[model samples]
Target chain A: MTIRYPNGKLYTPHTSVQKTEKKSKSKDLSFSNRGKTLEDEINEANDYYIKRRLAIIHKKPVPVQIVKVEYPSRSAAVIREAYFRTPSTTDYNGVWNGHYIDFDAKETASKTSFPLKNIHEHQMTHMQQVTEQNGVAFIIVRFSAFERYFIVPYEVLQKAWQAMENGNRKSIPFSTIEEEAYEIPTSYYPRIDYLPIIQQLIVEKCCGFESEEK
Target chain B: MTIRYPNGKLYTPHTSVQKTEKKSKSKDLSFSNRGKTLEDEINEANDYYIKRRLAIIHKKPVPVQIVKVEYPSRSAAVIREAYFRTPSTTDYNGVWNGHYIDFDAKETASKTSFPLKNIHEHQMTHMQQVTEQNGVAFIIVRFSAFERYFIVPYEVLQKAWQAMENGNRKSIPFSTIEEEAYEIPTSYYPRIDYLPIIQQLIVEKCCGFESEEK
Candidate 1:
């Protein structure tokens, strides 16, 4: 099956499904089975969280401008022509423990640094707005080559973004990410369990007062 | 121009633009100027709120399942085949003063009651989940025939929905809505102006603790 990305890129999956099945026979968490994209893993984790009644996070649908659509019957309508529209907000957002949570997932092949270009201007502005509203805003960055994931807070990201605008480095160094962001350990059930870290940040931000769990 | 709704319905403007232009000459807020749909007014209200930095709300895009695409160039990709997917969540969601706000906009032509059939089962389930997380959930019901708008809390909606599920009335009486829901006055700018009502809800739900204004 051909998967359409938000950027209009078509991704053809490698024989990873068969490979995953073969690896499942061993009944072990094989590193080779980690071929899923950052978005896919986050979506899977969101489903897990929803089922466990932990949080309600969802990825916003890809925006498309439909030029023409054909309705064969009252029920089925087929889109004949459409174009992708640039998203105004981040990919994922929802409520967690009465706090609004918003973030975008990004993955970089480079092991040394994550490029600032990976983040868009509008997304930065959206995150800024979210933080201003006292909502939790951050980006989940995956260093794909090293198989490392970090949740970089909006404040930290904004600082680096402003620095870049002021003729500084165009990328956030891996060392800076390691120091500034909260690293999420790889897991099986939820894939990337970042909510616990968010809960901690919420407590810290709220002056150490923890919200009651439902 | 044809506008595509989330349910794949096509909307053709009925010369409302020319009518609006003519109404502008009157230099008064005429009732004729209120021809815009509920969705359009809410989107306009959201834009107004965003500009004033009062809140950050957005309508989720229409979900589409793309089947075939043609890459004419590196920058341009045309979707050749696609189908609308059923939305799992409410249309609008965002944050206001640290509170997660989620709601759907519905319009009713019936002057007596708002039909329960207007809302889907998944939407009710989604709103339940949202409220479970202590997030604000509601429906903005527009009585088009009466030119009245009301913000109905999810708790009230769920009660009516449950009654319908138990083989009671399949519609919510307009009188019940008038008594239970908060009515929003029509305004020129920020057509719906729902954030203030949401703020009041936040205060009431938070046990009279008002969130600080930024």
Candidate 2:
């Protein structure tokens, strides 16, 4: 079967399957039936947040090093030759209510627990440094199978990391996380509605339990 | 006169002057006195700072939306076609003493001042949002010709934006910026030691001058 590009006419049998598959994909898309990828949903949610002037969170731009440029005319400069560079932080970062907020979102199919291995060493180090500098660092983990979400604090992840290093399980037990971190209630209003957890974190910080997990 | 692809080889009856130019360029290509390009120098500085655990700054990845992929083998995926995406933030971001630092480095040939047109409206807005969220937002303005530098605070630039709104000057005057912003001295070690300015900002913020920056 020959596949055709979306820009091209999909007259081939292979292209029809993908079109048919995308049509039925709406029902199986997300926890709330949002027909979009996780990145798309988050970007939309971020836009929603930004429009209301609620918070100024944004996904950063990718870095590029232009090796060669083509000046087709004075009107345009095209980077004909360019290279990619490694990213240092989570996919998203910004500020909320006079607090620096940094987070990474990950989705896992496992129903039981999210894998600790999904977090990278460099990212882990980054979170640690953020917390040290007084920024709020978190991981928004979606257990896609269960449609459950949890805002895992950097410290909680660090503790679990230590445990993992000591020959403990490679995943955080659901019970420990439930007892410590805030379980974000998924809703249609804000979709993620993570700001409430940030509010709680702020309150706790003001109360002098700044470093406490919960 | 003509210049072609692969390596831009200039063949011209323009002059033997072109010959001297190529020879001088090849001679200067050796790492004796003059070093790497601006991007390379910044990368080196980033590495220098990161090794000391001083900062987590990194250039963002090049944005490429892959359209067509060729899988010669199941294990190997090659992106055959892609389109670049516009960058949202400056090149570098990281955790600096708990402040989420976001900034872009830019240079121009103009001897008087850098052009405001070099920055996009979206980028300016993004930086403002970062400031409202309490992150340190600024730009590294390099007058590369003179080898002079200044860290232009987001607020200062924002004011310039507002001024332009009222039919005032479109660009911030070089004299005004040189007087207002902290002038960074070029050095032999670590190259761009922007940490000094950051330290000053930290000290000021720590000294109960937080609300005033707004």
Candidate 3:
């Protein structure tokens, strides 16, 4: 049997480990590196930002609900039974440049459209609430097949999500995302570098710079 | 044998359980309620605030480093070996009323002073960074023995922490805390009700009302 770890790595029982390894290899066949995912890139970027004192963004630890525990020694307690919990908010949030930044990083394998199922309803609801509170909220979408990353603002995401709910399309077409999202060009030290894009969005939103930028 | 859970609950092993049960009873001799702790009170307060859309604060999950896993079925995977990890940031953080809120909730059994050991160095460093970023950072200290809670601003906490680092008193004297911290009166729906105190502090900090308040 194959089990997926919370970090998205697959673990296989020793009996059929080879089979599981083959599946994981195939899953990573398209990307540049097998172990690195969009989440990893963003985490590295956050580390870079923190090192330079640019931001304090962090990925919230995965929540778990424990049902049973065992005491092996005086100082050691082991969780015997537990289950992963649904997060109440987006994966990442913090303060950057005296502004609240909240966002989630998601990657899709599809070449043409990003599946709506990739994002949960509760996450979208959280983004909406954060934005309503005057916080900067967005989604970092990576089309893994194309090796492209885009920062889609909460407004754009809301439009796309509502369109899906209204039975317009099940997935956000890649063309729509390309048109509406800001392409975050890759960098070396800070791999994802989404903060500048976030700042730009905030400036435009606050100053009504659509016409000025045009 | 008995084990203490992360939330401070005692877990007696099933073997020789009768003997272990007696110990737990004796340990709960002082508190008003054996089941409810300060963390529970703060969590309830956060829930109340969230439901009313007043704030979006959340406690970060306890971090655990998984060392081993077992797969009994296709979908069920159990962590067989894991250890608790030291958190890099304070537990609770979010956006509230167009401001970034970052804080940690700590309870001390001592009636006179809060031991510096109650908070980790990394957590205090994280709070310092948050404050430097213009985010509101504070700590909610509960003297559990007296059933008292106070909202201590980062400035107050920093002074105590630095004093300890400079070979001064190892604890923040209760008198000092009582003088510097805002006493948070308990409530029904929101048991800890610390956000109002946070707002007041922010108002004072921004408007330079320290002298006016005195």
Candidate 4:
């Protein structure tokens, strides 16, 4: 079955994976059976965090430019014509323990690498600005084939992005991702539980432990 | 001329003020002749901040629920039918020096009081949650009659909202606002320079000087 987003974009789930496959190298692939989009899981996790007072994060509403509308009554208004606008920033951002958190989530069907094309230039600039302001900035990437999730820090993404801009590799290899990114262990209640990684990042940023570790 | 918002709400600018009025008690009223909406000024201010590396703030896109859409071409998607969704959070939020800043901008024609009807319940709740998480939350209110702007902290808004909930007062009096809120002076480049007040807030939050001053 094919799904269509609100903006009329086609969403074909697991088009690269064979339906008859019964075995996988990683145990995480077993959880892929749920067939939920990475966005869905992240939103669920955010809700869980909000409920527990652990964090306050939210996915921004998709940007749309409304050109025409009809008001049937004082209380009801219907948009008759509209177009999706290219977002100026990332998909998700909010406050987490007085620390500004900003990130974008993306999923790749590729099993070996995550393409740089998945991110936009404006998003990179926005993340850069966020980091410069001492905000926690990162990207949550999901490798759909293996049902693996990783929290890629903004610095790592910037390095890879700069390399790509310099006519280097167009994508970051899975091996490099595993080495530089922190893997998010999947669970039930909060499907993606990525805040602990953010906490670690805050600690590292505050103590300058990242350079020391390097 | 009548202006309708994207959601089809009528925005009658300065409806209560007479066009022939040449005198006002406050000097700020003179700037109102520029005829820009509060939202516009705020956006302009944000752009100025972003350009100068002062702060990063953005107004969230209007929430729209797309019911039907048509793909005219692979590159163009047209939304044919949609409805506005009540936003679950404030209109503006972003990072300013590692502190999460969240706020809603509102304009009122009344010179006496700011009606509680201008705000939504969910927005109040969202601001409460943001404040509870140690984020800086506030509201920017513009009194069109006087062309006066005030930055009312979340605590002040909460108090007013709670009073309304208890059936005490349905609105916050202008006097109360003048007493509790910080007035934003109009400017040329940024138009509405409100960040200086935010800096003061951060100082108070960090050093508890607010209580000391009180």
Candidate 5:
């Protein structure tokens, strides 16, 4: 019978036990990610900044499978069969100047209310851990209608998530968000001028909040 | 022909067409991990520290194959034929106190030099990236001979890795390590007295560093 390896390679299963079909629910990420999903832009900006010693940030690569690889020699290896692997956290994380930066970029269709279901349990759990460690753990909430961005702390997200778990709100109120979050201004060069908000957050939330930019 | 999926599940080949496994000459990890190695201890320790909130650290769970899973219900799924996936980074990362922490732990029977071969290119790349972000990245090098532990920073590791790459040294110089690394004093509570080194790092390295400990 035709079988598949974990890397999505087609294989003929031989003398093995039987199991079920392969149909796992894939996360439905919108392909029309608004002008370079926040991840790509952040990575690019991180690259740009790090080279100049302005700041260092990085988006972790999408995890992948390497099945049926060819080691031409001890030094070189080629992947013959491979597949995409799911990530538990939103991509971007690294250091900004000196602050430990941890965040996820999410897109939402709704104009007024952002859906709590859009964020996964795993990402939330990961964010919680990041925050406990004194990292700048936040989410870049993109409300497409407003064409705006807000840097929402994980603590706020957790409270919002807990509220949802308690069936208090299926969505975080934009008013509450407006009050708590710093509105990120968009720009042409970096696309997301999050550093300004980050500066604000450093001033307000980060320990010994000081502006090194000036 | 009793064909099975990688998950060792039974499958029926499609009648219309067939896809064959793309072949390769590389070694299979499943075969290598068969002997019940102690490689999992670091992963376990990371989990323990994370759960206790003593530190916000974790070993990224190795990815796996889920060719066939039984969903007794829509909410629950049981994996049948899964194999451990390779990881890009060393087994641990998180926040200690208020500092970003990243590390890999390795043990060697060698009395003197720990082989650089234990650290992979991918792991080095991960360390490099973390360092760029100003994160305190390092490795927990364990000399099983005297049962000693040392927290070697990424800078030291990078230099050692380069030397190994240049074939100048097969392993890091023990003297260089003794001079630079913070020897992890053993303890009864956490087993690794990591806080002292962290304290040193904060005083010496982190920008706008704060004394957060009680």
Candidate 6:
């Protein structure tokens, strides 16, 4: 089958399908109605939200270090060599109702716990900084086997990160995620609708230190 | 001489330098101090501000379309083929004192007027949307020949854009820019100190429409 990108360019079949088919075939079937991955669903949701003027969120472009370029023509320059950059910030960020929202999306096949390995220390540090700056920050995790999506607020993630640093469990347990995070339901358009949960978080935060202090 | 990147990787001399030198040797020398362009100055300023915790600003990564990737090792991925992706939004954006700031940095050799071609229509539309959302949106224009920098607010740019569509002049005159824009002074560490002018713009904007109404 010929797969075409949004730019109308033909695209090769994704490599992950071949790598994970044996291990994750059932897991993939359980979560995605089509063959769309969690990232693809979130991207679609962002597009829907933007078209409706609901938010101005965008997935940041993947950073790459260009080592060589070939200028075939006056206007056409192609990067002949480059390396994938390790990002310091989250994958997504934007303004929503005058509030800065920053977050990363990750999918784990593990049903028992969401592994800390899915996130980087630098990303957590970035989230902490964003939170300190009065911005909304969180991670959207997908339990692919169970088809569950959760918005784990930075405050909760911070505590977990600190606990890990103190030599506690490296991964947050599934029960803990269920208890602390806001679960988002799947839909046709805006598949992983997360803004309502974000609004709830903002409202709770705005209520001062009463709850946090408790 | 071996060109070293910030990441300490050997970098080929940029092709644009070679091309631009032929067309604009004198123009290039007029603006850049110690081989630093306006963009480099702005980047340095951003780094300075970040270190001071004054603001969180980042230049959006140059988007790229990866056509082929070669994983030489388990951890290292090299992009074998890629194309520089065209961007739809402005170059710089981030949160500043609980405000979402978005803008583009443009340099023009022309001393008489800043050409409309320097700013893309899509970028102007994006700026308009950002302005409507109460986010700070503007353009930083560097007049290379004159060694002048101006922050042209979205309000002025929007009007100019509309006027251009209605058969007005295709560029904003330097005299007009000098009259209507905020001039940002250069400093040692933060070469293009723009946030102070941003704060001023915010203060003026918050005065309940008296000036704008006038």
The model with the greatest DockQ is 1
lDDT of 6 by residue, A1-214 (tens): 3535456776442323332323433335445444667677778888887777777778889999999999986677889899988887898888778778889998887768888888998898778767766778899997766767899998888888889989999889999998888888655455678888888778777875334422
lDDT of 2 by residue, B1-214 (tens): 1433335554222221222212322323543223334555567677887778787677777665544555665554444545566776677777766667788876654566667887888889788877877778888876655656688888888888898889887787788778766667655445567877876766776586643433
Where in model 4 is the C-alpha error above 4 Å? A1-33, A73-75, A210-214, B1-33, B211-214
Superior candidate under lDDT, 2 versus 3: 3
Residues A1-214 of candidate 3: C-alpha lDDT, one tens digit per residue:
2445455676332322122222332434333443456777888889988888888999998887766777887787877677677888899999986688899988776777888887899999888888877888988987766666799888887898889889898888899888888888665445568878888887888887763332
lDDT of 5 by residue, B47-157 (tens): 666777666665554445445444566553444334444665555566665566777777655655767887888888878877776678888876654545787888888
Give the per-residue lDDT of model 2 (tens digit) for A101-155.
Answer: 7888876666556689889987898788777767788888765545556788898
Candidate 6 regions with alpha-carbon error over 4 angstroms: A1-33, A209-214, B1-32, B73-75, B209-214
Runs with alpha carbons beyond 4 Å of true place in candidate 2: A1-32, A61-86, A210-214, B1-35, B74-76, B202-214
Q: Per-chain TM-score of chain B, candidate 4?
A: 0.82
What does the lDDT read for residue A29 in candidate 2? 44
Q: Which lDDT tens digits does candidate 3 get at residues B1-214?
A: 2445557776442322222222322433343333355667778788888878888888999887776777887787777676677899999998886688999988776767988897899988899888888899988987766667899888888899889889998898999888888889764446578888888888888887774433
List of clashing residue pairs for candidate 6:
none
Q: Please give fnat for model 6.
A: 0.62
Q: After superposition, how far is residue A20 of candidate 3 from its true place, in Å?
A: 16
| Alpha carbon deviation, residue B139, candidate 4 (Å) | 0.4
Compose the digit string of candidate 1's lDDT tens values, residues A80-171: 99999999999999999899999999877776788999999999999999999999999998776666678999988999999999999999
Task: Please give the distance, in angstroms, between residue A60's alpha carbon in candidate 6 and its true position after superposition.
Answer: 0.9
Models ranked on DockQ: 1, 4, 6, 3, 2, 5
CAPRI classification of candidate 3: acceptable
Error of 4 at A52 (Å): 1.5
Ten-residue segment with the worst summed lDDT in candidate 5 chain A?
A: A17-26
